[model samples]
Target: MADMQKALRARILGAGIVPRVIWGRKVPQGTALPYLQLFAVSDPRPGHLKGYNGGRTTRVQADCKAESYAEAKAMSDALVPLLAAPATVDGIKFGHTKAEGPQDLGEDTAAGFVHRMSLDLLVWHSSV
Candidate 1:
């Protein structure tokens, strides 16, 4: 699972897309940007969380700058391989979901970045 997260993060940052700083702010070139928190949900085991269903959340921030729509797509494209990759352990499946709430890129003056992402996993042991 950790590998999957790392891979996803690397993929996104490697895309070379720089995001605009909110509404219309200019971000300095060559400036180091903080990573975005990436979330992941793990499959639930039987009796674990008792009837809560299969769900988990993990977040990892990445550093990158988005300057165009294609750049955004490059970031978005990283999601697929991450979701496709299965958990290291057996009887566990995982996938990624988009974040919820408002987004401010890198500004917290008002509310900063407010994205809540979730992943759904199925536990094979549940069938037992």
Candidate 2:
């Protein structure tokens, strides 16, 4: 099977809402504006009673961080429609992507402080 986490991260970048994306890590100081930080919202491999299907479902949170709230929300808004379209990235085929909760987080005052907007995602994928 294709690497699910990597594929998901790649997909977000490939979506082109923002080219700069970091997966499961802290962004360094002075990184570019309007980047995305991705984190798992649910276990990548949950217990499935029906043995292994060729595909897996994973949930992730994609955060849009920018110096301004408008920029952050705009980047996130761009992603909402893009996620709904199915596409293949890397070695993985995205069967579906659904987004939830733009959960307006106003501003964060730590680490790489910025106005942040986050979306919870349900991703369905398989190795192609």
Best by lDDT: 2
State TM-scores per candidate: 0.30, 0.82
lDDT of 2 by residue, 67-109 (tens): 8888998998988788788888878888768889898886656
lDDT of each: 0.35, 0.79
Candidate 1 Cα errors over 4 Å, as ranges:
1-35, 39-65, 87-128
lDDT of 1 by residue, 51-127 (tens): 64444444333322333334434443444444344433223333443333222243333323322222222212111
Model 2: which ten-residue window has the lowest total lDDT? 39-48
Q: Write down the RMSD of all candidates, one decimal each.
A: 9.7, 2.6
Pairs with backbone N, CA or C atoms under 3 Å apart (clashes), candidate 2: none
How far out, in Å, is residue 89 in model 1?
9.7
Best by the TM-score measure: 2
Candidate 1 residue 64 C-alpha distance from true site, Å: 8.0
